[model samples]
Target chain A: MSSTEAQVKEKKRGRAFSHFKSLVMMQLKDKLDLSFLTSTKQLIAKVVFFVLRIAAIIVAAYYIFYYSAFFSIFAIIAWVPPIVMALAFSIIFILSVLSCMVGLMKTLFFADDNRVLVTMPVTGNMVFFSKLVVYYLFELMRSYTFTFPLFIAYGMVSHLSVGMYFWMAFVLIFVSALPVAIGALLAIPAMFVYQFLKKYEPVKVTLFVLVVGAVIALIVELIMLIPENINFINDWPLKYRPSVISFIESAKTYILPLYAITEMLIGTYENLTFTLKPSNALVFLYVLVTIAVVLGIVYLIAKPLFLKMTAQPFEFEKKEFIKAKENRKRRKYKSILRKEFLLNLRSSISYSFLAVYIAVPILILLLNKIYAAMSTNILGNYMIYAFNLLIILLILLSSNGIVSTMYSMEGRAGYMKKTKPLDMTFPLLCKIFYNSLFSLISIIVSIGIFGAFNSSSIGVGGLIMLALTVLFFHIGHMVWSAERDIMNPQNEQYATTGGEINNPNSNFMTVMAFLVSFAVAFFSFILFNESGVNPITACLKLMIIAMAFAAMRIYLFIIKVRLYYREKM
Target chain B: MRKSVVLTICVIYILSIVLVGYLGIKLAIFDPILYVQSIELIDDPYSDSYKISHPPRYPDQDFVVKEYSKGLKFRLYCKVMPENATNKEVEFIVNMPDNAVGKLQITSDGEVSVLSDDFDILYAKVYILSKDGQKARSRDFTVQINNFKNPT
Candidate 1:
């Protein structure tokens, strides 16, 4: 009521608004600007990638909506709208939260300007608040992209009103907030744990990756087993797994907050269209209050802890270099290969790439197990197609992009590679060899896992053909990426707003090349192998094709290396 | 320029998905799926008597033969292809329980029947072959019966 107090409040509001705006601008400039694309190739790749991603989302939405309508007729008879919506919304919510958690971690503790912000006249709370605001904006875009199609599909199916559409839009904005808050809460502790284990970086990274991979495998196993178990629930002889059923029941109870939102949405629409269900409105109020209280609690807890947690740097003791005896006598190329491996292991990003290398095959193997389980009846005829497809997918996906950014990852240190007193193409060969180790390991593991579990044998001859196919691809892809990077390397030390590095061109080319290769491999397999030809003969022909491709890539890569030297001179 | 491109992509993506989704809805609602619904055993008293007298439940409920019927008579259920499409070639191959006595028959109108002389819980598999490349096979259907030997 006092003019003086009003002015003070107004200034504070103005200051906060300005801070959020500035922070958002900073993020856009540093991390999200399209100018970071640099070249036309990268720009085109980004555009294509964007289109493909949208297409996938559209396809997924179409299937979900189609199936939902099919089941909704029965669901409506059962009057299970609330429960159905809850499960759907919760699954999507959980997935979104998991995805956003890494981004939250980047924003909260690892932002590039954190050190400067701490020393500024502004309070830590202000800085934290600004960061969260920026994070919310990002989450909003992501949440909209995912949820909008679902909403459209649902609306088209359910024949909802214009008012409901507006209400749904309003509700969608806050849908991501719960997930983001949860991610922040989890990520902070994870950061602390990461800092604690910083001393044994290599071992820690390995363990972390293994642990994550195992968790993924376990989740997948559960997903595969749950449907089968549920199917057997009514069979007296095949008694339902009570433990899993109970765990699912408990999980439903725990996800009540998400259930509440779903209930409110459905209830609001129902109340408008049909009878006045007082319980629906009551549930809506309850859910709103719960969300507000939970958010308040999170804010209160995270405010002070954010500064302290972010300030604590990861510490590792320095060690003096000591000359060690040669472990083994190795050739020059082998030594170069070892060096490349060592460099990749030292950096977190490169190590993450390695983790992908190890994790992909295991993931594929688990999936193959599920695939094998599903096709128990049609195993004899289907095995041939499945095996070839699996091998191609695994080799193509695993070996892809790992070596694309190999030289770019060196940043300024690429000059060292250029000036090295050795054959230029030898280093590139070493890089390819290093990548092949991963590809070969993946292929062997996949073959072993599939062979051990499935009744059908991928014969020795088939294995040899598969190996040759994979080897050619791995070599061909690695050379392609290395050549691309050598021709137009991303040597700049570019840092995003969140202390993340982005090698736009190399990363783009890497992914684009892999996708193109995958598409070609897929169609080629479908054409040559699936045309009623004998599978062995088909595979041999495919191997010959791959070999020719590999030979061409190898020749081109050598030419690129020679061109690079000539240009430098 | 960038924003327009993004907008175009988003528009194209949404339209394509909607189109496909609409098509999917139509398919799910209207497409007639050919499948074997169920198999049944015709009741005969002698077969029931024999099965009840036997202690070990050799023929489980799924394959149980309650009556001693001389021959197996099971109805075939299929959703035919589109009405306009004529001359749809359909064939049925039955693997009879007693390979020696069982015979396969297809009427002019594409009716399939299996005739057998003697049956003591006979298991037969019905395989459907169609010209349109659409196939459906029934699970092993069991028939329980024995032709009574009079005064032998």
Candidate 2:
């Protein structure tokens, strides 16, 4: 080979190794970075704050463990079923990482970022690795937040040996990595399919991927709940030891890396003086085979598809233009409402996220039903109420992001409203109307699902409660957007970088909005009962009150927008 | 930076001392030695054996000896009842601390009553009386007792 070509090969090799090292460093840096403690004074303050928080948690945990009988009962009751469920979910969760990759690939490669990256000298693998890292980081954050506490509690309660502690730590780290590896394996095929199927043909491909994904999820759920249904299966082999063995074996296969790390930590090999039986091997083998088959199928489908799709040239066809003549001009409110609804429908990502948010409550309710069937005493009406309350809280907490992002989503394109001859109130009204509508939809869907399960006075009460919550959140959003001056409004399209912001009024406004909403909900509940009204009637009254609040909010928005229009950027 | 380091070290030291003092107090207060004592059962002369039923009339009513010891111990008991009784099995159980290891002994008055090999006695001793009456009175006794050890 020519010296230049040889040099190119050597550079390529070095680049690959450097990229690997950077990825590892990035993950390590994320964990170790203490930049949040910049100044000495700030560091001290943060240390004190963190110490207090940790101490509070420790004190609470101590009280729960030592002082509370209720906590003891709760711990015992929660341990087996919830832990098993969590474990099963984790396994399924591992598999779902692949589906997430498929979803991400569809979003990223077809997204605006792909256009920017495609022209660069970077190879497909580099872009792929970067996206994989991002997705993995997201998964890690979520998994650790939810699961690590439980694991730590388990260790402390069990008084685990040093070996066990090390094993658990290793398993945690391995488990975190497992999802990423699975995501990579899943994404490669997905990207290939995306490459092959351009021009909405990929929709079918994506749907197929999703269907397979859903089926795998369903299977995992079934497997996780298999022990609960052990009595139902009549087969002799499955009736006794084999079923348990098979389940464990399957668990081990997908999570062998985790198991390996755990075993190492626990000194499983050294401790096993007696005959130690390993059961999950077959299940593990099945998972491996399934992964291989799926990969093969994706590759076979993708190679031909990528070349064909990429070769195709972009074309735009002109159609005969006909414009509908304006009838009697509709009311501005109706026009604004229509425009808001259309905007949401046009943005696929927003619509999809909204759809998922709506669907989640219903899915939870269905799962509750299944749980009730399996164990009626454990999953009862009280759980239903708690779940509804949780959903309401989530919707309320999430409203800020959804609504604030709506303002940000406007981008520079929304600046034209300033030049328009229309009243400043029109655009402001439009934004608030759209945001409220979406929030209303989410609230209604969640409450509707909650109501479906409960279907009682309490359910009606909960619906009323949530309606008030949604209204409060909506009003809060209106006040926030109106007051908080946006510098480089285009940056809103991106996710918020820091938890804090420059606007002094923003925090005060949010706090006030939340307190007012809470008070409104509380008073409405009290007044309804005091008046001796039926729950439905009470809810209707609350809804009317909420709408009145929305109306007041719109009035405030109009004033704010006028001020905003006059104010310097 | 030096002040911060010193402060951090001092804080850690204070915390360590507090933790150790607290733990020391806890250990002293909850010391197993304070609570550990021999559980004594006073012998009652009023206690007498009576045959309630032949084929185990009540599930809860078992011929149980009160307390038993740890290892290498035996208690011989003789019992006499009606001749027509078909059940000849005597149940022996031992109640001790979770860590205690022990064995039990029951000697019948005649060949009518026998100890079952299958019984795994850990908590209580049960004796089944057979109706081979040779006029024998059964008095329960325990030997080689050990102090109950706390697992913690």
Candidate 3:
């Protein structure tokens, strides 16, 4: 407790605070990603996307209110607000826990900047605590951005008091801390499992594929669980109906920070008094204490473990050295193709999409079961076929984003290709070749499964037509996307930012994916259901359209890529 | 390996074309409503009477038996079939014989009604016809109305 010792301690504390501030600012800038706002075109696109996202949340709320009323899931229509709120809160909390868990694990343990941060003049614990603080702010920002729309929707629907609205905002700010704490605990076991998986590539990739597939399937199943045309809606077969209310009420208490929030908000807003209920105040205290205990344990364990893990050199270097000793060589095209395929196999953008593509056929079969269970007899064979096509195309085209970013992801290698005497078009074509192959196989399998199961209703002819149409469209879309990137490569941006830059090409492709799928499905379904037009004919028309687009993309890329490459060089 | 993939894809493409063309021969226009497969006259399980879902196509066929002693109005549902058939809409008609004893009427949906609770046994021929002119008549059309009370 000498004066000099106290002064040194205070100076270190100040230094840690400064480090925490700087780290948080950097993280926020990266996360906010308002680079797109500087350009008018990107700003407009982003605004539209933001508006659409908010509208989607509101629309989802609208459906739950009406759909519940329609099904008489609630005894009275007046109960719609509570049901929507409870469901929204529980779902939001669950989703945040998952997102925060993965994000925290990566940010806390695996951020590339960690090595540099550790070597700084600050103490190890300062770096550890600073990272935790920075990440807490990150989780807070993310939760707010995502949940803000939900708050608006909930408030508008419930007509809440200003006090209650402010309560919601306050809860959002600290709510993410609980997940980060829980995720920190969960990350312990998860990291060990991850380390184990990394040792075995095939096992890891298989598990990765299944996990992605299962997540998508789970979402689809949740959507399908809603009663489509339940006749007994107004007079639902219920002994279980009253219990839905009880279930939701019970769920509200179990929904974590939301429950605490509800307790605090209800206590404050009563009779316009600022006083808190003793029991409600206890719940808030419980949340705060739980967060503190978790952080203490993480500090006791994760902080030291993280420092040790960072200090060790990366484990992959030795294996890479052994591979280099093997001295494998191949032709230019073969080597380039192998490199592309290897990147995919190692779970790049292509790999993730590949997993989804492979899972899609199975998903189609599962969705078809639900469709059959719900009695698709109301729709025609052609209509059923059209729907199946829509599901397949939506998944396939959305993955075209992988193709759009392929050139830019090459980093320095992309520019180096221009310096060499490589055939620019050939290499670009090779990039999409594997994807096209993988996509075609998946699309065919999807068509086959849909056709086989519904053969009694939908003819095999529709299946073939759908297969051709989507395949052509998939290839054409890939080419078009790749062409866009080739003409205006973002390799420098990706290199500088470590591939965390705002990629307009990828975003545009995703938006276009949704619009194109809907248009194709809607138009073709209309045609097929029209009298005197066979499914084959309707699909034949779609096939021609897909082929024409593909042909145009192929021709343009062939002629334009070289010219663009020369102009850029 | 790349050549092999290209080869396999080409082969599959050719096969798909041939297969589609072959299977597509059965691809006709909208599956037409062929016939009234079953014109079932069954009581509703959920209720004693069934509410008709569509407007009466044969409005003239819907008649009340005037000059009767009691209310005997009852609706009978006609279940049309060939589930994939387009426009399964049906109309009902009563082909009354001159020798029939009791006054009877049928609605477009095959509802059988007579105002009298006490009438001599009536044998009325009821037919269900689709838009394509295909007909199906219920063989169990005789009503023993001698001591019958109005159920509806």
- Cα RMSDs, all models: 16.4, 15.6, 16.5
What's the interface RMS deviation of candidate 3? 16.8
Q: For residues A74-138, what per-residue lDDT tens digits would candidate 2 score against the true structure?
A: 22111121222334445656665766677555644444444444445655555445555566566
Pick the DockQ winner: 2
For residues A286-374, what per-residue lDDT tens digits would candidate 3 score against the true structure? 77888999989988888877887778787554653333356577888888788778766665575566666766776676656545443
Q: Is the docking of candidate 1 incorrect, acceptable, medium or high quality?
A: incorrect
Which model is ahead, 1 or 2, in terms of TM-score?
Answer: 1
Q: What Cα-based lDDT does every candidate model obtain?
A: 0.56, 0.46, 0.65
Q: How do the candidates score on chain B by TM-score?
A: 0.34, 0.23, 0.48
Candidate 1: Cα lDDT at A291 = 54
- Chain A TM-scores, per candidate, are 0.73, 0.55, 0.75
Candidate 2 TM-score over all chains jointly = 0.49
Write the candidate numbers in order of decreasing TM-score.
3, 1, 2
lDDT of 2 at B147: 31
Alpha carbon deviation, residue A371, candidate 2 (Å) = 17
- lDDT by residue (tens digit), candidate 2, B29-121: 321212111111222211131222212444443342322222222223333122112332233333346554433343332111222222234
Ranking by DockQ: 2, 1, 3
lDDT of 1 by residue, A424-521 (tens): 88886776565567767766665555455543444567556756766676667767877877777766652112233454544665455546445654
